[model samples]
Target: MADALTYGLGPDWEPGEDGLPFRRAARVVVLDDDDRLLLVRGHDAGEVTRSWWFTVGGGLDAGEDVRDGATREVFEETGLVVRPADLVGPVLTRSAVFDFARVTCRQDEEFFLARVPSGHDFSHDGWTDLERDVLDEMRWWDVDELAAAVAEGTVVYPETLPELVRALLDGWDGTTPHLDESSVLGPST
Candidate 1:
């Protein structure tokens, strides 16, 4: 008989008090007109790792402020300039140990919500050193559609993102967001 799949799967639990059951990372969620969320499809490094449908954000650099990193990442990935807005909230999502193995180090990721002006153009060429792979395609969809995609694994955001979106929509008056340095993003991890 063939060995069970779990035979070589190793223990189901994580190790060390600091070694979390899941990997933590940061992201930025940008919603555009037509109510569709913007997502980037790219590589984390130079490898053919799993593709993700994520907001325009990425890992915080060593000693980098959260908001600067978020905006810089957005510009690098999408070429759209934006001001960091509200703190949608924080998310503590998990990932397999193997997924984070390639990362030089690990920490809990922080996220912030930024508003993209309707008239702002995203078609430009800008680059960041941390960019794993460049993603040119962008898409938008309704919240319900997004939720379905997330549930079906067709769309992926940070684990805490959906709830944050719901909260933003519930309280949003569509007014211009008040941008500030203190209101900006930085690593909370």
Candidate 2:
């Protein structure tokens, strides 16, 4: 419990016997005009030596609209102002059970698509202390690069991100794909 609070999980944070936490997050699959995707790199606070790459987003505020939450996450995490109306689709959804900051979180996440100009500099704004402690870097990724990273034993959440990004190369086809069944994310995942 002290570990959770120390990592800024909040005083209200408490997991059940199975370490089941309550979370609903939003993610933006940010694609630049050059076909590169934006992602962030981080690790569970207790496992700082091992890191994973994931899209830029976070949990929604209570009662927030989905797209609005998605866009808010984008701006807060990346300093990229994405209008809610400009986001493409809630193109994907997934259930993720993962460990971060020594807490096991079960997050139901929605993925939105945002298009940015090429080489929009990374100027993250308003990251909480937890993010500063766990998040390491933010970068633009090409699809093949992501695939290669995964192949080389790097953990990337939504393990199929490369494939999904490839499918969106021409634009989302008006269908939202569920990325996975409820699954734990890790190296073997």
Candidate 3:
């Protein structure tokens, strides 16, 4: 198996002529059953950003397509293979994070949604090196759990995440209505 630490950032951090926000590249979100969202846990070297609760993805390789990167990262981080589906289109989300007490980072992230097959086991026999380590735990979280996490400021969902939830709800003809307001459901703002 290849070392997970061998991952690359692809592009170097270069200051723009005007010193504006730099693009952090794109990512993918894989939505599972029960309106539960899939998040990958990882360590951040920055002080204020010691840990991150976000989707499973990484910087796009040089000249690599976004879709390919999304698919590769998902499989690498969770052993869950997925194909990109429509949700909020290609959304460019610009946000700031305090990496350290003094260092600030503005990230421009591109977001996409992918559907995880029902009954897909992330701990299946096909997990990659990084997937096994980064995703030590995986569960189908309830809407309330997600809401609480968001409210308490624990997890950070991508900007297009809600839209993906809505899309899933719309396509799901199943019995239970797992997503509603105050969480992945409710309003799209």
TM-scores of the models, in the order given: 0.58, 0.88, 0.59
Which candidate has the top score in TM-score? Answer: 2
lDDT, candidates in the order shown: 0.50, 0.77, 0.48
Q: Which runs in model 1 stand beyond 4 Å of their true positions?
A: 1-26, 43-49, 84-105, 128-136, 172-189
Please give, for residues 67-93, the per-residue lDDT of candidate 1 as tens digits: 777777777767777655544443223
lDDT of 2 by residue, 1-189 (tens): 333355566533445445565567788899999899888888766666878888988877778888998888788888888999998888999877766656566677888888889867766667877777778898888889889988999778788889999999998999987765456545211
Per-residue lDDT over 1-189 for candidate 3, one digit per residue giving the tens place of the 0 to 100 score: 222222221242334333422334456656665556776555433232344456666655557677776676667656775665543335334343324222233344555656555677664354444334444455555546665666766545453344445555445433322221222221010
Q: Candidate 1: lDDT of 187?
A: 17
Total backbone collisions for each predicted model: 7, 0, 2
* Residue pairs whose backbone atoms clash in candidate 3: 180-186, 181-186
Q: Using lDDT as the measure, name the better of candidate 2 and candidate 3.
A: 2
Q: Which portions of model 3 miss their true places by more than 4 Å?
A: 1-24, 84-88, 95-103, 123-139, 157-168, 171-189
